[model samples]
Target: MKRQFKKHFSHNSELKCFFYRLHFHYDFYKKWGSTTPISLSFWVFTFHVRENICNLTLKGSVTVKIISVTRIIDDMGRIVLPSNARKALNLEEDYLIMRIDNKKHHIKFSSSGRGKEVPIDESGRIPISPDYMNKLGWETGTEIGLFMQGEEGVLQGNAPSCVICGSNQALLLVKKTHVCEDCIHTGTEASAEKWSAVLNDLFQEYKQYCEAAVTFTNTEDVHKARTKGRRLRTLIQFIGIKKEHPLYKCLKEAHDILGKVREDDVFIDAFDKEAENNQYSELYRKFIQKAEEEREEHRNELKQKLPHIIDDEFSARWKTFSQDELKDCVYKLDIETALQKYEKEFSERVIKYQKIKDKKSDKGLDSLHSVRKKAKKLRYIYNFLDLVQSIDYSRKSRQYKKIQKDYGDIIDLRDWINETGSLGEDIQDDHDDVKKVRKQLNQRLKRLVKQVEL
Candidate 1:
C-alpha cells in the first residue's frame, strides 16, 4: 500500500539548518508506497525522506530563517508587507487567499488556493476584512506581527503602544495614530506657549496703534486703537488674567479714552453726511461744529493719557505677565466651559428679549441691546478659541456678526437722538430743528427694528 506524506520544517538552533518532519497519511496512498524513500531538494540542500522523518545535512552552515516583521494597522485597517517578505513569497499576483484560523488564533495568507480572495492594493497593502477584525476584536492602530511560514504568512496580534511616546497606558487612537494621555497633556502645554507668543504680538500691535492715535497720524487710528484695546482686554480675561491685573487696568483705561474719541468721530461723520442735504444743512452744520470741538478735546485727552498707558514699562510688564499667567491657566478647560456657559446665557437672553418685544414695550430696545452684547461676547470667545486652538466656530461667529450689525445701527441712531436732544436743551433756539432731526432718526430706527430677526 502507498502512504501519503506531508512536509514540515523545524529550526535547529545549534546547526543553523532546517530539519524536515514528514507525516505519513492516508491522503497520499495513491501517490507513494509505504516503504518508498522520497527524494526532496530545497535551496541547495538535498534530502531522502524515510518513514516519518528526515534530516538533511548542509554542505556548509547556512541560516534560512525569515525574520519576523512588524506593522501597524492604519486608519483603514490596512497593513503593508515588507519588500523582502513579498520577494521571498513570490507574491506577484494581485489577489491572495485569506484564511482565519480561530483555533490557532492567527490569520494565514497564501498567494493562491481555496479561500476568500482579497485584492492587493496598488500601494501593496492588504486591507484586513472588517468581519475578520470584528471576530478578532481588533481596531485601527492595532499592532500586528507577521512571520513567514514555508510558502505562507501568519499574522498575530500584538499589544498596542503609543506612537508618539511609546507608552502602553491610556492609549487613544486618534486619526490612526496612537496617542497617550501624557502626550495630550504635553500638547496642551505647547498650546499655552503658542498663545503666550500670540499675546505678545498683540500687545505690540496695540502699542503701535496707540502711538498712531497719539501722534494724530490717521483720523482712523483712534478707532483702531480702541479696537485693539478691546481685543486685548477680551483675550486677557479669557486667558484667566485677573481683572485687577495692572495690564488689564491699563488696557481698559486706554480703551475708554479711545472710545470717547471714537464716539465723537462717529458723530462728526454722521453730521458731515447729514449736512450734505439742503433741508438739514444748518442743523447738521451746528452739530458738526460742536462735534469737532468735542472730538478735539477727546483727542487731546488721548494724546496725554495714551502715551503714559502704553509706555516702555507696559511692554516689559506684559511680556513677563503673559508668560506667567498662561503657564498656570488651563485655557483648554476654560474655553470649553466658557463656550457652554456663554451659549446658554445667550439663548436665555434671546428668549427674554423675544418676550419683551411681544409686549410692545420700549424696554425691548434695552433687552435687545443686552442680547446684542451677549452675542458679541459669544462671538469674541468663539473667535479666540478658533484662532488659538484651531477649533472651528466660524458659523457661530458669522451669525453673531450679523446680529451685532443689525442692533448696532439702531443703537447708533438712538445715541444720536439723545446727543442732539441734550445739545438742543443747552442751545434753546434750535430745539425745533433738533426735534425734526430726532423725528427723522426715530422713523429710520423704527424701520430698522421692523427688519430685525429675533
Candidate 2:
C-alpha cells in the first residue's frame, strides 16, 4: 500500500533517483497518505539487464521496477537532492561515507587512504587539489573514506590492519600482507645467521673440490669435482654476491675448463659404443679412433689447467675471505617474493625462444641452444638455494624440470640424425637402416620442436 502511493515518485530520471516501486491492496493505500509511500524494502538484488522481469523470491512476486539513475554535478560543485531522494535517505546537512550503501560491491576506504589515492609526491608536497578535497568534505586532518572501484584495484570487504599498531595502514605487503615497515617487517638477524651456515658449508666444499680435483685420475672422480665447482658458481649467482668481489671471475673461468673435459668424454664413449654395435663396424671404428685421439689431447690439457686454477687464484683469495660477507649474502625479500622474481627470470627464456620461433627465420635452431643452457641453469637454481628448504615446489618443479629435459631432448635428437646421416656409400648394408633412422629422428625432432611452446 505504501509502495502503491509511492509509484508516482519512482524512477525520477531528472534527479537521478531510482526507487523500488510496489503496488498493494487498495485498503492499505487508503490508510497511508501519499507523503508516506510504501516501497520495496530490499537491501540487495541481482538484476539481470536482459530480462525485464524481477526475480524477487522463490514464491509469487509483486511488480518491482528497477530504474537506473544518472546524476550530474551542478556548476556550484554540489549535488542537489530532489524531494524523493531527500525523503528516502532522510537527508540532513551532513552525512558519513560509511552510512551510504549503493550496494553493488564492497570496497575498503580507510582514514589515511592506504591502497587509495596517494596525497604526496616524492618531494613531500601534496599532489591533490585542495578545492577537490573540500568538495568531498575531506579536510587536511579529517579522516575520510575514498572508495575506488576501477582498473588498479578490485578489493572486496576489508583488509587486515597494520600488523604492528592495529591502525588501518594495511597497505604494504612482504612475507605477510598488511605488515608495514613501521611495524612488523625487519631485516632479520636470524635469517642472516641461517644463510651464513649454508654459505660456509658451500665455501668449504668448493675449497675441498679445488684441492682434490687435481689428484683425480678418472672421469667419474673429475666429474664430482666439476659438479662442486658448478654448484658453487650457481650459488654465488643465486645469492647475488657482488661480481666485483675478486673470486667471481676467476672461479667462473675455472668451472669452464672443468666442463670442457666432461663433454668430450661423453662423446668419446658414445662413439666407442657405436663402433661395438654397428653392422658396419669399420667406419665407426675409425670414428672412435679419431675421437679417442681428441680425448687424449683434452685430458692432457685438463691436467695442467685444473692445478693452475686451484693454486694461483681460487684457494688463496677464498681462504682470506671473512664470514661477514657470507652472513650478508641472503636476500631480504621473503621466500615467496624471491621465488616470483626468479621465476620471472626463468620465464624470460621462454619469451626469447618464442621470439625466435615467431620470426620463422633459419637461425631458430641455432638460437635454441642458448635457451637450453639457460633452462638448465634456471632448473637447478633452486637446488643451489637449498637453505630455503621449507619452500615447496613439489607440483610445479616437475613441469619446470620437464621443460628443461624437453630442450635437452631436441639436442640429443639432432645429434642422432647427424650421426646416422654420415655413414657414407662404403657402408652399404647399413645405408637403408641409417636412412630410416634419420627420417625417424628428423620427424621426432620436428614434433619435439613444436611442443616447445611458451
Candidate 3:
C-alpha cells in the first residue's frame, strides 16, 4: 500500500495523512459501499465534478469587482460564485486558478477553450502576452517572422488593426490572445506593447502541455517539449542572466530532461540513413563519435544537481525523529515546518538587498537584476515547499521541471561547440550545428531568467 501510495503521492509528507485517510475510506467502502460516510475531507483537495464553463461564462464583457472573487469559504463549506463572475468566466468545473488583478484576486474555473491561432507579423512573429513575452525573450527590437494559413475570425472592435490590411476585424487586443488564420495569405506586423502581455502565458501553456505528456506515460508523445525547450534555451542566452539564477537552473533542468530524449531520438533516426550511405560514412562517423562524447560529458554534469535537493522529512521531524532519520529522510520530513524557516530567512535577505537596490538612484544597476534573481530563488524554494505537500509534485512546477529536462542539452551543446573549436578542423557543418545549438541555449537561458525573476 505504501509503495503504491508513493507512486501517486511520493514527494510530500503532508499527503501521507491524506493518503491513509483515503485508503481507510476505500476499505470501508468495500464492506459497506452504500453506507460509507460522505464527508468534506473526501473532497478537500478534489476538484468539484459539476463545475463547467456554462456556469461562469460571460456573454460579451463586464466590469467586475476583483475583491468579490477572493472570498474565503466558511466552515459550512459552501461557496456561491458571484453571478457576474459565473457569467463572465462561464466556469462550471471544480478546477480553480487564481487570477490576481490590481484590486484583488479572483478564483477562476479552468475550461478547455478551443485554441485559436495567433496572428504573426510579416517577420513571422506570433503575438504574445506581456508575461509570455518576458518568458520568451521578445522585448523591444527583436527580429521575428509570421506564417499563417486559412481564414480565422474577425478581431474584436477594440483590437489593433493590421498594419497592412487596415481592417478592424484583422486586429487583436493588447492583453488578450489571438490566432490569425489569414497570416499565410496576408502577413501582418505588431508593435512590442501589443503582444507582450500573452508571451509568458503562451510559453507557460506550451511548457505545461509538454510536462503533462510525461505524466500519463513514461515517455513524451508531444514533440513540443523538445522544440520549445530549444526555443527557451535560445531565450535564456538572449537575457544574459547569471548562471546562478534559479530560473537559469530551472530551464537548465527542464531542457536536460527533454533534450536527452530528443537527442537520443534524433540520433537514432539519423543513424539509418547515415549508415546506409557508405560514401558519407566517414563524416557521419565523426559526427556520431562527437555526439557520444558530448552526451557523456553532459550526463556527468546533470548528476551534480541532486545534492541540492531539499529533504522535507528532516524538517518535519526536527523535534521528535531520531538524529539519523532526521538527517536521512527528506520525503518524510515536515516540509511546512521547514519552509517557515526558509521563508523567514529569505524575507530578511530580500529586505536587506532591496534597501541596497533602492539606494542606487539614476538608473537601475545590473546588480539589481542579480539581487532580484536571488529573491526569485527564494520564491522558487517556497513554491517547491508548497508543492511538496500535494499530488502535483513535479507536473506543475515548470521552472524546476524544465531544468531537469533540458540541462543536458545545454551541457552537451557547450561541449560539442568546444570540441569543434578545439579540433580546428574545417568542420563547417559541425560549426553550424554548434551555432544552432548555441542559439537555442540562449533562448532557453532567457526563458530561465524570466521565470526565475519574480
TM-score of each: 0.61, 0.50, 0.23
Predicted candidate 1 versus true structure: per-residue lDDT over 1-454, tens digit per residue: 2111112222223112222222222332223323334222221011111100111101111114333557788999999976666776777688778989998777888887777888887677988999888888778998887766346777778544544345656544343234455655554454555566667777778888889988876778888788778877877776567889998898888888898888888888887987897597888888878878778898898888888888889887887787666666643234544567778888898898777643223687778888988887767766665555433567888888789887898878877877887666665578787888888988888888788788
Give one digit per residue, the lDDT tens place, for model 2 in 1-454. Answer: 3453244334333111222321222342243324343222210000110011111111122221111122233333222323332233332323312211235343322222233343322222222334444444433344322212111221223334533344544233322223233332122333344455565677777666656655546666556667676666666666565667667776777777766666556655665676677664565565455555655676677778767766745665765443456434443223444567767766675577677743223366556766666555555566544333333444455555676676776776665455445433444565665565556657878887887665
Clashing pairs in 2: 2-38, 3-38
Give the candidate order by descending lDDT: 1, 2, 3
Candidate 3 — which residues are off by over 4 angstroms? 1-285, 290-334, 340-399, 402-412, 423-454
Best of the two (1, 2) by lDDT: 1
Candidate 3 worst ten-residue window by lDDT: 47-56
Off by over 4 Å in 2: 1-187, 207-216, 242-244, 319-322, 331-338, 355-362, 394-396, 412-454
**RMSD list, candidates in order:** 23.8, 20.9, 27.7
lDDT of 1: 0.67
lDDT of each: 0.67, 0.46, 0.36
lDDT of 3 at 151: 18
